[model samples]
Target: MATTGESTDTAARTGEQYLAGLSVGEREIWLKGEKVTSPLDSPELRSAALSMARVFDLQHEHADEMLAPSPDDGRLVNVTHLIPRSREDLERRRRAIELTAALSGGMMGRTPDYLNVTFACFSGRSDVWARRGNEEGAANIVAYQKLMRDGDLSTTHALMNPQVDRTKPEAEQMMGEVSLHKVGENDDSIILRGARMLATLAPFADDLLVYPGSDIRPQDGRYALAFAIPIATPGLRFICRDSFSKQRNTFDYPLSSRFDEMDCVVIFDDVEVPRERLFLDGDTVGYSEVITDTGWRGHIMHQAFTRAYVKLAFAFGLGHMIAEVTAVNRFDHVQEKIGQIWNMMELTRAAIVAAEAGSFEDAGGVWYPDERPFVALRGEMPKWIPRANELLQLIGGGGFMATPSKADIEGPLGPEIEKYFQSAGADATRRIRLFRLAWDYLGSDLGGRGELYERFYLSDSYRMTALAYTIADKAFPASLVEQFLED
Candidate 1:
């Protein structure tokens, strides 16, 4: 728990400081079938960690835009942790988020800024926690927020319980299927046992936050818990999915090699959660309210929308580059497909602008991005992202499939490749590099994962659209529609 001194020189962490914290943690992370001794020793995991470190370095480089003076300690912290009291504050936070997304080309979904703002949202409305008679929880939130801001901790969250028999009540779900649950409570701590899924970026995160998803029911009190723990906590093990970045040459798997934020299933076997770490426990109402009443949904989605927009922009740029190399930029149909992607990118950008314009302060005086634009963006993204990939693949054709490997270009067959593989104006190596990037985004295993990630990252399309409809109904009530019908 290092504190930032009040001196102006004490500001947000540098890339070196962030990496040092990650390098020494004793985390139990499994990849494939074996235990990973040190995450930094693994090429894929280390690359991802380095990618995140770049984000911290960017904050230091653009301190005025990304860092702001903390009210608690006059030292500057990342703008994402600032509790917004006005629209101007919200705009500053938005700029910080957008800049982070651009730095990662929007591929890094769980950038540290997202959760920093989430905790900020909780601290912004501590009274909501107090209403549930958990003043200690409220205090802990404020303290945790300051700790994160001062230490510049990176976090990943596991909110969705393991997918089991969804039709069954959460209480009826199989033993390990329902995620970390309260087994016993002592004076100082509560013991938990179970597992949580889709802990994205778990290997790179310094800490983990376990919270209830949108599906928690009233009867699921024992399962309805929210807390944070160090990633190295005893008895907490992370079983990772296959690493897409493993052993692939960087030239072949550009995106995956650098930006594979490994997803994991976190199993907590009798993990002890100290009272101070518990934000909500056994209270289903409080668990739900922590999300709904705290204004987290709008704020978190604002970050997501910004990231998705940047990701799409990257896809569009990739497509444009490919068209130029392939000499298809002149073809009408190719131009039409590029236009489609451009339109999607512009719409996503517009949604962010519109949401900010409609930003409003809640009763607690915390400014929140307008929910309507987010709902619309979330609803359309599932289709738009997949389509963007498909267009890239369609335009790219066999170029994506037939590109020479990095080894081949430098091997004995180099002359043959140079002669036949060269494009209109580009040489063999340049053409292959551009197509390889396209493959990474559209044709590789990493590309497939990106599609699936975007499709469900925000949740299912049906639910998202329903949420949009719900917001529209509230904005334009049926009573108002009745007047038009009667006239």
Candidate 2:
């Protein structure tokens, strides 16, 4: 509920301005082995890019809820970039994150706001970087936070090492087979080479952050680095996976047609990261500490939980609608299936609310949402998402496969198709539209990709469970139970 000082005075741009910025960039991107001149060149990529731009436009309209006054200047900036020092600030950020997730129907995973919170976390604990005797690195973190906040820049990240042979250690693997590393550094910049996997939304973003993933050993020093660079940086190329947004008819593939954020393998063929952009270099302890000790993980998890909640709500609503159109809402078994989805939705909603309600301040005076609910949400979502999709498929029955195409609805068979496809309460067109949407969400390639994304979005399941257990152990120490036991 914090409005901008003036529409013209705000730092954020409208959706059109964001699109124009992307159109002029000379970034390298490839899909299906061909070089793409720009994301706008492909209809699918362009739709995804436009969908992202709408997030910025939403910020402009709801500036009071989304924007907060910058510390250095009076210009209103995004709440995502706010470094929360009080409980109210945390609540404000939670509201902003919810609004953005709702705008995209919780499908746009690498929205600019995600990284905004990352930089905000770094800025809050800038001294952690300073402790490495890299004062410049500390300054860079603060400056980059201001730069992105004031400019409203969109960013994606490539944190995972390239998935090659997991048996070999990163240090032992061949240079190209391992993750990105610094091969050379000059007085002004460092030259990076090698590749990083699964840079989601890289082609559509304004910048990319290259950072260390978890469990990095000290021997992997060359690969332990953190920095940000423009997407158009020379030698920085994105080799993309197939685009799911390629659907021409929005009605047939409603969600995929607009929300397919193309995932890619970001290749850095000697890309130059200027000294000013470097946040960490060869400091394995510092690199690991920055994420674990700075409350950054909690902040990022907060955004993820909020987004997942919206997605669950969307899925639940779709299931309910499907039951109505199919006239199966009356059946006891069908109602029970719907009830299962409803229960998951309610649980997710409770996690989001509880996380915020139990928010507490960290050692640095930054208020973070309670980690327990977030960790639980992360652990449960992988299972719940697939089950929810299965429920939709079950309720849909053969209708998911038998739905008519857009062309069929408008051609010679239109009348016959309509007469036969009409359901109890809905006409043929209405029934077809609903089924098509459900198919796109549950049966299409897009839906398949989403299931995979949700399953591993936070990382491997066993690792996540271990992490949750570790947190719980510390919060409720095992020694407490020993005192009550009889010897």
Candidate 3:
């Protein structure tokens, strides 16, 4: 592993390079009640590992769009690591994000670019992490960003505290160490114990980024912490959910096989965080300000919303294909269902465009998309994908259930499948393949997880709506209504 200020080859990494890095260290990944020695060694995780490698390969294949010239050296790096200084830079970054998202049809949400954009924003506003006299921590952020950028490392973040009891704050819970908190400090590092929830991509990621998830009260300073560390660090373990990638056949489980991108509960049992790797400490006020103070919300949403737009577009195309193959598009209700998905795609695209058009450079000289549209979109976004999935179910109707498995189609039932499954627009083979994809995306376990992830990935939708209304500037619009009433 590279030290705090270590340098590496400046060129962007390839898929092979990424796969080789996973074997350099041992990560404690627990899946299906067993300790997985490595991602490549586990059947459930290998598909996602290869899928991510393909993403890296695609970046190189389309280097003109995804790779950018590093600011420090003239070497090429992923565009997600590029700090945007102008709208043109933001557009270039958007192209990279959109291309990556399209590769998985937006099924893999935590692709490496997600955190790459995050650290770029954090490093650009390195001053904010220095608040409360933590200059050393701020410098660490800059060095870490360059380290990851130069190496093209993949990182996963765990921000949400474990849900031991929802009624009380973490500090007030019956268990004192229920959530990840500081226990002691040595001359050179801090000792941490407890765990964080929902670290997607933990098994395959090179590093883990931990930060304050919710607002920490001043009295709960012990619970406030932030840092970056390798996933293989001693005393760190990741317990993942059941594997959704149960089937290896692409025809049977198209999305799940390649895009599970597993989520896990990250446990840090007496883990030691080196001083240089610690970016935020016991400063509660500073911890509360990290996301906004660094303009990370707007910057990350650039990648998120772009992925969302691609997902909705995929949903739209699938819905249309299903309707066309089954001859349902001739009906009014089917057309309306298809149009609903199109509307969602257009709305997301409009939000992305509006946010970029309203982009502004912050006081730290870092550019960010306008967050107002993103905030509004978040309130509506939690429902868009699920609703699209529901519409797909309605559009496909009985066809989803009647579809034959890849094996059944190639077995003794082959002649029956061809004779009975033919549709108005497609032959039996094409129709089965198309409908199977729809089912994999709409009815499978991976599809359910995708819906749940969208609903809560950015936090509770109701709370987001409340916060949006609370922080929104409404005086001018209210005044306009008041003047009309007076007249």
Candidate 4:
């Protein structure tokens, strides 16, 4: 309903205006062999851009209800920009992520300010080191939060160190594998070298949220740094990878037609980080606490669980549509399959409920799930959800894979597909439509992408769901352990 003025400078841009506002250089992409100057024109990049732009649009169109107040500036901040000030606030933030996931069918279309909120909380709470008369880190925190509020910016985080020879010390092992330590003084700024492990749309973000996830001894102070930088800062080039939406067939597959997330490996080649932007530099204790903090874990847990919950909703919706077209709703086995779907949905829902209901710690206005329970759920999903999808496969039989391609439906072969693909009262035309819908979830590359998206989130999708029980729990009664051991 609300319109964005293309040239008008306001809190944010409209979906269209936001795209228009981006510097052309920011979007110049090299994928595979071709040079793509405008990612918006490239099929692979369009979906991701569209999805992100939608967030800005929401800020303008739904400003009164969905947006939150900025404490730093007292202005309205979009859901992504709103700081999480309580446990309930964290849940609300998680719900917002879920809404976007459902809109994009869990394809990883990110909402900005995601990592910023967590770090903002960190800036306020963490102060393990002192540099100047003023603990500059804490002061930078306030400034950055205000910066985020003023710019109405979005940020992307790169934390996980890439896999390397674990036998080596982290100082050596994580060197080339992730955002490594760079040179600089405790002066006006710091200079960073090396690169990050996994970059996610950093090229397009307004700023970068870089921090270490590993435990750090005081000796590892060089690696225990936290900082933010504008994407266009000198020497900060985000070397992106080839888009996964590589399929050449653009007319047929809609899901693959546009990927929702464009994750890149950001290359910080001798990048300069201004001092004010540096939240934690050369402070290992502070850096470790910020990450291992319940604030960080709670935000991530809530985001992952909510994303999964929405994913199940999308999966089961397609499953129901498939059953209807085939008229298998009458079959007892089909009914059982539907019941199975409901169960998977419940699993995700229960985890969310347990998290909110069992919230253990509250800080910076955000509530974190108990480490034990959250970790348990984190380690449990991969094993169980796959089996659920397999059951959907069993009931649908070859129906999932048997679906005709969208191209066939529109081409001369369309008639044949329509006649044969239709199920029960529906003709091949109707059935193929349903089948194509199902294909997006269970058959095509999109389906695989969905699974890939989830696989990327859970600790290990191949591991047992029961592994959750091990990591959770603060204290164990020795008597109970002794009785079990003796028995």
Candidate 5:
């Protein structure tokens, strides 16, 4: 507990300061074969970085909405730190998710604090976990939570291991093969090697949080390790691929206008992490069971809802645009399409809200979202939302497909374009601009990938549901099972 000005030191730290401090790693990053002095300076990464900093600034600018005081230490903390002691706590946590999601415009926007709470809720009652908890695991959870509360830093997760060799025995997973293993310890730190893909915010985070995913095989303990390292630590390089924004020329691209930031493949080339930051090491079986079932599903489901909300917002607005442009706004079919979009939106919201409301209390006076509704919703919604996007897309039609460049308006073809393609009542010029806005998502990066993402998301959630079932053995009543078998 540092004093108020410094009290929690975590409390007063704003998004701007965090972005300023990120310069330490900028010198190490290279984009397009050139080094950058401030990673935040690049247009592609800058949007995401600014988005990150905006979150911090938001804490100050919208303190009541973005933060809450943690009861554990009376420290003013981001709502990401909230542990639902009751349904109200759970609702507050969901609202926090909503606020941040809205702020990031639902673009890959969770801060490090998101994972911090998972570690908190379970770790706070490490004793129940210890009910049978290995003392070491208990200690590990507590230590991790402390660092979390201190706002020690931002971190990204490496959950999806790169699929390198499917033909090999599950025992020998060797895709480019960058997994953590104990090489030898320096006097003060542990060294890690091997690389992991899709660290969602790794490119600009202070630390990288590597933990075992359910996909990890127990024999592959080397890959089961969990820990963190500074973004510029020796031997760690963010061998990130080309930016998604780089995939296009800026003039016609819309999703690239302000989205697609902070995701990259982080390659750890035998990097060393200070001991204090290490939470779990070489305990794959333990890490898998703990992570996959312990509490991840709840947080993960909550995190995805942010995207759902964003997509819904797009649909509502896009639906109306579609109806108006097609001269069918007053038509029953068009109105029905619009209604379907709203129904899907409300459905997703209900799932998220219900999951939070039904959360059960835990022993430490803390509460956690119950898995049944969440798991059910997680399994069902991803499958449902793509249809909404599909409806939005179908209604959009050729207007969605023939998106013209923004520069076209200023070029020689401008006058000819205005003469032919305008919507019913609007001028050709106005229609082009409106269609372009629709094209941004309906035809461009956000739209093209959105429905696919929903399908992928639904498919992924389906797998997670199976994993939960496998872990909990279908939440079966074993005593009754044996009795039935005997009879």
Candidate 6:
């Protein structure tokens, strides 16, 4: 293991440094109708914040695996920020991603590394932002990438405009005016007002990123914008959903207590983004091309799909454990249920390997994973994850509810509990602990949110599937069919 400060000549910030950064406390993060003055003091927010800090520390402790030298300077950076130029570099990044994912059993989706990878892609394809009179935007991207890399900043992004009404065009809706759109600009800064949703990990992050969440219609050009700003910027506020981290008992609400990354709707009240920070400005066509043309799609999906694989593998392991403890591994039906989860987990793993093996250099000389595999994986995950949860529920059955609380196991009922709760494979205490964990993972609010996040994380899975079909190369397959018919 590397010494505390020796991870690199310029050390990645430690867990303590990460926590201290959050303590400066200018960011407006509201939870349960009150502004969180100190994230470390809030019972609901502290564990998740600490969880992120731990990952930051992990970067230091496992620096050999996660940290790399910055291209511009010798300062060590996270592999997520490393601009991959070869398959070897990509494989190195994959290992780091796997380590981070395995840390939380892939429960924390918006780990800082997620955006670390994002900014890396932005830097890798800075030229894409240089067209159509936006040379400054390209420069801002590369500069910002280095800024965050050197700081080892934890960042979250709010991409989706609030879902107020789907039937009407955004400009036509009553609440549409409040959706995040550029209102005006001064010489040094662009002013924005309105709101964006699903900013996961907003409170804990050092910065918040805003970009086009969907297609920008030509008429909605005023809404086409992208920028990164401090989460504490004046006129910025994060209104969070009620926390799933309310339960503090690590044993009773294991997953919820530790990994409840909060989601929020970010309201911007004429927030000013300085010229140097704005990456896209009211250019609808350019905004639409950023992800696909700049290598962000493939890179982001590479990180996301790695997490998906880890999450599925975690689910499978949890299911297997439940079966083993209850001795349900003996039954054919139970075995079949277990096999279903295994199948999905294996497929996800296979996709990651396939994508990496077929990695290619884009037109800009940046290497990208074969995004094709993850496109399929992303669409199928929504279906597979929910069903995996169901199988775990089926395997555990009423045992999830029958388990005793942590207090009950330790109180006057201890003797009676031990007598009754023991399984063939585990003692009563062990049995109760396992069931409580399963409940926390499958039945709690966090569990429900996890399911929803997977469904919509990369936008609607249904649309993703349609997009895969639309963009796929059908010519070769069609030609083969025609050849057979002619023969």
List clash counts for every candidate, in order: 0, 2, 0, 11, 7, 0
**Every model's TM-score:** 0.95, 0.95, 0.97, 0.83, 0.83, 0.97
User: Can you write out model 4's per-residue Cα lDDT over 1-487, one digit (the tens) per residue?
Assistant: 1334322234545677667645434543446666455556776776667667876686666554446655544455555545455557656666667665666665553556456456555644544323333377677776777677556666777765555765554477745335367666656778887666666766456667776666766776667777887766667655566565645453445566555466666667778888888777776666666665536665566666676677677667767777877778788888888777777778778877777777744644444554454566566555445555676676677776676666667888877776677677577766655666556555555566456555554346444244444444535566667777873
In angstroms, the error of model 5 at 412 is: 5.4
lDDT of 5: 0.63
Per-candidate Cα lDDT values, in order, are 0.84, 0.84, 0.89, 0.62, 0.63, 0.86
Cα error, residue 70 of model 5, in Å, equals 3.4
Q: Judged by TM-score relative to the true structure, which candidate is superior, 2 or 4? A: 2
> lDDT by residue for model 6 over 265-335, one digit each (tens)?
99999999999999998898998889668888788888988898898888888888888998999999999
Tens digits of per-residue lDDT, candidate 5, 170-217, equal: 346654254445665787777766666566666667766666565555
In Å, residue 77's CA in model 1 sits off its true spot by 0.9
Select the stronger candidate by TM-score from 2 and 5: 2
- By summed lDDT, the worst window of 10 consecutive residues in model 1 runs over 1-10
Considering every candidate listed, which one attains the maximal lDDT?
3
For model 4, what is the error of residue 188's alpha carbon versus the real structure, in angstroms, after optimal superposition?
A: 3.0
Q: After superposition, which runs of candidate 2 have C-alpha atoms over 4 Å from their true positions? A: 1-8, 175-177, 474-484
In candidate 4, position 152 carries an lDDT of 64
After superposing candidate 6 on the true structure, give the runs of residues whose Cα lies further than 4 Å from its correct spot: 1-8, 484-487
Better of 1 and 6 by TM-score: 6
Model 6 per-residue lDDT at 110: 94
Better of 1 and 3 by lDDT: 3
Model 1 stretches with alpha carbons more than 4 Å out: 1-6, 175-178, 474-481, 484-487
